[model samples]
Target: TLADAIFRHLDHGAAAGPSLAGRHALVTAGPTHEPIDPVRYLANRSSGRQGYAIAAALAARGARVTLVSGPVDLPPPPGIDVRRVETATQMLAACRAALPCDIAVCTAAVADWHVANPTDRKMKKAPGATAPVLTLAPNPDILAHLAAAGPARPALVVGFAAETHDLERYAAAKRVAKGCDWIVANDVRPETGIMGGAENEIVLISADGSERWPRLTKEAVAQRLAQRIAEYFSPDRSPA
Candidate 1:
């Protein structure tokens, strides 16, 4: 298989350093669109840049990457298997299909709820007419599903928490609630321009404690994360 061939080449030619040569990584990125009607849907400001960068970085470290992405304008990263999805349910399914992976990173800004009964046609707004009521239901939690204890669960699971206030507290709580190994939390307040922006400021919360990272380009963050992942998997290194 092409994937096997690529890993074989990586394993043979890699320099003396941390290498994921034959590891598999599953990553989810972008914002899910929950349909309200045929023409309208709920979404957020995720550009998928950070997710894409992470996928690329992992691949650079010799991990075979499967990027499950939501609708976004960015081109697919080279040497990656990209699975495009439109809704949270679809994203979850895609993630499940890429199972038995070594690492799982849930970075997509999936909507928490979706319209339970979305109309097939475009909803029209008529003058002096009552607005149509949309029944709402919770979307499937992809991070929790991936982090759940099971034979198929990845060795490492990371979740992202984009928040407005009390970032660290909320992120720490989320890590436990979702059963993920780490939570990368960021302030998404409009003024911060972190969401849909080129740079990010994050606090990486894990059982060991929180590590505050200075604001840096998404690519830099991805590289740092990929390095950390490699270190975590290194045979000589102790578990964090």
Candidate 2:
């Protein structure tokens, strides 16, 4: 009850202004785990720091933020609604339920494929019986689904591209393929220390072109991105 009251006070504009007071934002964060069995699962290295920061930033701008998050250790940001999920399918469903929002940002590193036939019980070695095979199935593409043309489609949909090679080309192509308004591209190679790290270096690709941003704290990036979204929704700008 104390947490709820605190969040309510923060949501009531205690620290945030009213620039984006009426807007609603939907964000997906963390790494979705695809189950192999009761004891085994597949996941990525995402820490969910960036997405959580983004949610906090948007909330600070006065937008109602609904964060559909995957399994992570981070605490929920104040003045935001956080819905936790474990798989990509669940994440998509949660995102759909929070739709008709003004902004959607897909920052979760969702698995591209999941075990099609997960065992009900824990898998065992059993003295090495030729190693059990795992049939992989394609997971639902949440970003593209949100970017699809429809009445519930958000005005701005942003996706993240964590690439190890050909970052710009791949990110741009992904933007086109996903039909999202923007793609935040980043190098996630282990050497870059960007993945699962506290700082980030990103190149924002949109219809307007790419803008390379300096390496900064994840919170800083979130603030800049939130400011950009606020600018896009400013009263003076003509609707796209």
Each candidate's number of clashing pairs is 0, 0
Candidate 2 — which pairs collide? none
Q: For every model shown, what is its TM-score relative to the native structure? A: 0.92, 0.91
Error of 1 at 34 (Å): 0.8
* lDDT tens digits, residue span 1-240, model 1: 999999897764343358888999999999999998878998877999999999988888889999999999999998999999999999999998999899999899999999999988989989999988878899999999999999999999999999999999999999999999989999999999988899999999999999999999998898888888888899986444
User: Candidate 1 local accuracy as lDDT?
Assistant: 0.92
lDDT of 2 by residue, 1-108 (tens): 999998897675333322677999999999999999888998988999999999988888889999999999998997799999999999999999998899999999
Task: Please list the C-alpha lDDT of all candidates, in the order they appear.
Answer: 0.92, 0.91
* Stretches > 4 Å off in candidate 1: 1-16, 238-240
In model 1, the Cα lDDT at residue 38 comes to 79
